[model samples]
Target: MEKEEYLDLYYQMVLIRRVEEAAAQLYQQGKIGGFLHLYIGQEAVSTGLISARQPQDRVITAYRDHGVAINCGIPAKKVMAELLGKTTGVSKGKGGSMHMADVSKNFWGGHAIVGAHLPLAAGLALGDQYLENDAITICMFGDGATNIGYFHEALNLSKVWNLPVLWVCENNRYGMGTAVERASAVSEIRQKAEGYCIPNDCVDGMDVLKVRQAAEEAIRFVRQNNSPFFLEIETYRFRGHSMGDPERYRKPEEVKKWEENDPIGIYRNHLIAKQIASEEELDLLDEKATKETAEAVQFAETSPEPPPEALFEHVYADVS
Candidate 1:
């Protein structure tokens, strides 16, 4: 990869971190509403995975989707606007934090219901197959979603029909407040894929390059075989489940330990070690991300709210 590509990845990860940090502040100030889930520690998973996708490939994921939307090319300004319910938002202020989608980018949505989007992903892959397009669908969800019945049905049909889909499980070790081992029948999420006979692998989600490599291989396998591939990305979310979460389930020491493996720090060290970038160059990128995040917040704060009539606009399709 060129130095430019490495830096772009670094910038994006930084941007996501900065944006989510600003979002957390906004949520506290009541500038944003609904459930606010920050992609603080798990930035590398979406950044690397989406970076590996072809534009024709569709991406759909669970409600924890701000990072996913940014990865799919939704600008930080638009994402922030959506959070503030501004009309300029990607979903035109209708979807809020959990429903941002831009079909033009082939990003399906931010589904609020747990595990509901899995079947939707299968449907998307089937569409690509029907059109005979060399496209695929990438479905992302949490470890908790794997416990849902939809997870089982979707994986089964995807395998049986050989749908071109990548089922990415961002196993952050928890489903909301419950630890994976406490709730899931099998702690290793890929085993569920095994039940459905889908090809699967697990990788470190904290490292961006490793994720990108694994994703390239997994994506290549799906594209070549025209079948579903499951990836259990081992990750941890440093923040609480939501802005309002009391977070009594875990220890502070555990979070500090994971924080030692911070994705941004890891990638920054990698770039320096590989002679891909200098400390000064990376520092500039960090400052740039912070500025961009501030500008996005300003844009969202100044953007207009949806007009009163907008409530009736996207609620139903206008067939006429």
Candidate 2:
């Protein structure tokens, strides 16, 4: 990637971090409600993988999805508005934090249920293949989702039919307060694909370049073979599973250890060390992202709420 590309990636990561921070604050202030999941430490994974996708490709994921939506080209103002439950939000405020979607951007809805979107992603890939389109479906989920029945079922059918999809497991070590060891028989998520015969690999989710490289390779494999692929991105989440989480599952020291690998900070240093950008330039980018996040909050604050009568509009499709 060129210096300009690196800078853009840095800008996006910074913007996402700021936006998630702001969302957490808003949730505390009662400005946003209903399951505020912050993507504080997982910014690089979303930015890298989403940046690797074509415009025609479709993306889906479980909750903890604000970064995914933003990286997939949803505007900060709209995403924040969605979190704030304003009519101007990406889903017109009906979806809130866990259900934001922008079909025009090809971001399929963010699923609140664990591992439920796996089959949906397969359906999308099947549709794409049926239509003879070259578009692939990227389904992202957390490590917790791996143990679920849908996870295995989707992978099985994806292999059986040779669907074009990428199953990305963002393994953040814990699945809603329970450690991976306590929940799964096999802790290595990529190894779960062995029975299904899907090509699989693991990537460092904290490093944007590594994540992008791995994503590109998986994407290429899917495109070339028109088959499914799986990637387990080993990462950590700085925040709790949700806003009100007691967080008794992990120690502060463990979090601190992972914080040392802070993705944005590490990438910023890389840029400066390689002469891709100056510290001053990076500082300016941070300032810009902060300003944009503030503006998004203001927009969400000023935007109108959805009308009660509008509730039924998207509830059902007209079969006629």
Candidate 3:
């Protein structure tokens, strides 16, 4: 990657952190309604993963998706608006935190259901296959989703038909309150991919560079082979599962230990060590992210709410 690209990546990671921090504050203040899942620690996963994808590659993620929406090219202003339930939101204030989407950007909406979106992801890949398009579908889900029957069904079908699907499992240690060891038959998520005969790999999700490399390779494999590839990225959600979560299951020390490996900090240190960017330049980016986030919040605060008459708008899919 170029020096500018590395710098931009840093900016994006910082922006995500800053925007989400503000969102958390707003949620606490009762300005932002519904379940607000902040992608505080796992910014590196979507930042690096999506950065490696082409425009045609489809991206679909789970409920914790503010970071993914931004990486998918939805402006932070729109993201904030959606969080505040403003009319200018990406989902026109309809989807809220868990349902941001821009079909033009190929970022299929984030699904609120645990494993329900897996089959939808398969359908997306199938559409591309039917149209004879080379584009691949990148479906991201939590480690918890894999435990459901939909996960197995989607994987089995993807391999059987040789669908171009890249299944990315963001294993953040715990699925809600349950740990992977307690819920899953196998601790390592990649092992499950083997059962479906899909090529699989694991990566350190805390580091953007490592995740990017793995994603590039996985995307290449899926695109070239027209087959499914599973990637289990070892990530951790620094915040609670959702804003309403009491977070009694994990200890404070454990959260602090993972906080030490904060993705933005890791990438920032890497840029300085590699001489890709100077401290002053990076600091400017941090200031810029803060300013951007502040402006987004301001915009969201002032943005109009969806009218009551438009309540039924886009509630149902238009097959025609």
The residue-level lDDT of candidate 3 at 295 comes to 98
- Report residue 137 deviation for candidate 3 (angstroms): 0.4
CA-only RMSD, every prediction: 0.7, 1.0, 1.2
The digit string of per-residue lDDT tens for model 3 on 300-319 reads 99999999977977767985
Model 1, range 210-300, lDDT digits (tens) per residue?
A: 9999999999999999999999999999999999888899999999999999999999999999888999999999999999999999999
lDDT order of candidates, best first?
A: 1, 3, 2
At residue 135, give the lDDT of candidate 2. 98
Q: Estimated TM-score per prediction?
A: 0.99, 0.98, 0.98
For each candidate in the order shown, give its overall lDDT on alpha carbons.
0.95, 0.94, 0.94
Q: Pick the candidate with the highest lDDT.
A: 1
Considering only N, C-alpha and C atoms within 3 Å, which residue pairs clash in candidate 1? none
